[model samples]
Target: MEKIISHAISERVEFVLIAGDIYDKEDQSIKAQVQFYKEMKRLEEARIDVFLIHGNHDFLEQERDRLELPKNVHTFSSDVSCVPWQSPTGTKIHFYGFSYDKRHIRENRLGDYRKHGDADFHIALLHGSEETKASEHDVYAPFGLKEMKQKGFDYWALGHIHKREILSSQPGIYYPGNIQGRSKKETGAKGGTIVELSEMGATFSFFETAPVMWEKKQIVLEGKADRTEIYRATDELFQTYRDTLCSYVIDLEIVTEQASKFDADEWLQLFEEMRTESPFVWINTLRFIEKNQAVSDKWYQGQFLADELDASLAELMEDETFF
Candidate 1:
């Protein structure tokens, strides 16, 4: 994160926009604050401003009011508010947002941010879950993508869902995701977006900032005739992926009925010993797949309802793309 912030110095961007969730906790540690202060100080020295809001994870109630922020750092109010920034080129950009007052915000706060300003770029800054049946989120600041797109804003800077996606490009609604992958679940290139404006409208692009990445890889051990062959095949599998571009925190899944043959402790020990053999692979998980564990066709023959559910579960679990 510090490295990326330092990189901003050379980018010559007018300002940095962080939608929300800068810290994991509202009451962030002194070490984190000090580090942030130093980074912001550097940004200020480069004449780069930073505009940000607080997400539910770092709600307003948990803010440290005593710590003085850098002059270049601008924070939004707890209530919905709009701040307009005029570039030296006379282009006006209005940023609208509010921080979470409580831990869970169930209300649809989009109503508060009705884009009424006339500016070269009107961007809505939001930090919450999008309304979709497929999502398992706790419905924080629930909002629909359709309504957001209809608001006539030039862009939507969204947060909380740490998976960079541009849901729409017509008006440019973007989620930059998180700058750092704090856990294995966030597995991919982690970074922010760079948007350029011209007569052609806004052109968006992404940059890589994460020092380390989390990735999942599965090695099939079914064809290995015995434990010795299985061990050899696994080593070959690692060798094949040893050329992975970046340093990786890997969750390795070994798929085969041979899982029962090896002791977990010994397998992990072997993995640890050879982990450094690959330049980039670090085994964060060593899971053994127990192949053919699903119930047989005979078990589902008599019970129709049970068979239907069992079939669905099997499809969900066995489908290679489910994850």
Candidate 2:
């Protein structure tokens, strides 16, 4: 976050749009408040405006004594609200958004986003998941892509289901993902989008702010391979990424015919011995993948079991009695 603030200052951005999830906890600690305030204060001093909303992780609490932020920082209330701003170049922008008052919000608030005040640009900040029958994300503030398109907004800045997705390009709908990958599931470059808008159209570019990245790599050992061959192959893979600028937490998968015979812990211990060789890379997880397992009867059995489980889940989800 410090890096991001510094980048924004260096770039001299007119404003910063933080969609949601600024804090991990609903009850924001004094330390978190102090750190965030200091960053926003810098923006205030630079004559830059900030617009932000609260996500499910850090919903609003009426009774809590909220820290007063700088006047330049504008926060959306629980209800859908619109705030207009005129840039230094006299471009009128109307920002529409709402904050989460509770952890679970099943309401579909996409329709609530309406262009207001005849502004040059209409941008909506939403922190929610797209509505789907089945999804890895929690279905909070559920919305459909079609519904979003119908709203007629100039741009949509979405959040919650991180893994930066570009849902649409015509009106510039995007989820910039989280600035940092906190888990193995989120493995890639993490950053925010820099948008330039005018009456003619809009242009978007992504800026990288993450100092550390998470990556997954695979090493294939053809046929029967001994410990020496495995170590050599792994070393070769690490060598490829030795000159990279950033540090990485790597999930390394070893694929071989004798995968079942090799132990993950053993290989991890061996790699740890060579840790000094590549300081930029750290092995987060070591998995043994059997190359020929897909053709085996056990694989077929596993697939059948998975299908059955999915079918059961679908049926359960459809049952009105459970609801």
Candidate 3:
């Protein structure tokens, strides 16, 4: 916490903007809440204003309203509100933000906010889906890149999509991703964005500040996989991390449809050997699925037996009903 504050202080960032989903949940533990407020306070003491909006996960409600926040921290209301910040460098930035009133908000919020022409740089900070087909997010808060760009905002900082991405090039649209990857699905180096705005234009930079990192590596075993094939794949994956120079937790997925001739014991032995070789790598999860080419004669034979059994059982049950 101190390190991040120190870094922000050194960077001399004008103000910090958290687009949305600031908390994993509104019911976060007291310890978590305290720590969050502590960091906000530290930033406030440093004379940096922090603006945040509620995400789908942390919708604004009576429960959230009860928590006490420092004066330096400001949250957006249900209605669209614009907050302006002036950097010591004499550059003015206007931030328009809003939080989801409920967990599911199916309305176009962009149309509500009046477009600002006075500010040097206009930023729209939101926690919603920009892609129409982003099924992973709430379908209600849908907006397109072109529409947002046409709205006349200089930049858009978006959230709710866990994957970090710059959605559009002509006009800036960024999903900084989540600060901390809560689960295996939210993998890779997760963090926020640092925007630098000036009279000339705006440049955006990404900063990874999460304590834990999530990475996924897919290994495919081609045709007729064996113990040696598994060992080779494991070795290749471990070798890739040799230059990382830090302890890493890796989630590996081995995908192939080819059925291996190796027995379960042999596979287990290979996995044990790989674990012994790479102590730094923690193989927390492993999934195995049979990738058989097509319906085999053996499978047909088993199906025939199953059909026969089903017929016999039906006949037996039909003849002898329980009184």
Q: How accurate is candidate 1 locally (lDDT)?
A: 0.75
Deviation in Å, model 1, residue 320 alpha carbon: 25
lDDT scores in order: 0.75, 0.82, 0.69
TM-score of each: 0.83, 0.87, 0.75
Q: Could you tell me which residue pairs clash in candidate 2?
A: none
Clash pairs detected, candidate 3:
188-214, 257-291
Q: Write down the worst ten-residue block by lDDT for model 1.
A: 314-323
Of candidates 2 and 1, the better by lDDT: 2
Q: What's every prediction's RMSD, in angstroms?
A: 5.4, 4.7, 11.0
Tens-digit lDDT track of model 3 for 81-163: 89887778887878888888787776667787566658877877788776544344334367766678788777777877777
User: Where is model 3 more than 4 Å wrong at Cα?
Assistant: 1-6, 63-66, 131-140, 198-201, 220-229, 243-249, 253-279, 287-323
Question: lDDT at 82 for candidate 2?
Answer: 95
Model 1 per-residue lDDT tens digits across residues 130-176: 78553444457878889987888877788887888888777877888
Q: How many clashes (backbone N, Cα, C below 3 Å) per candidate?
A: 0, 0, 2
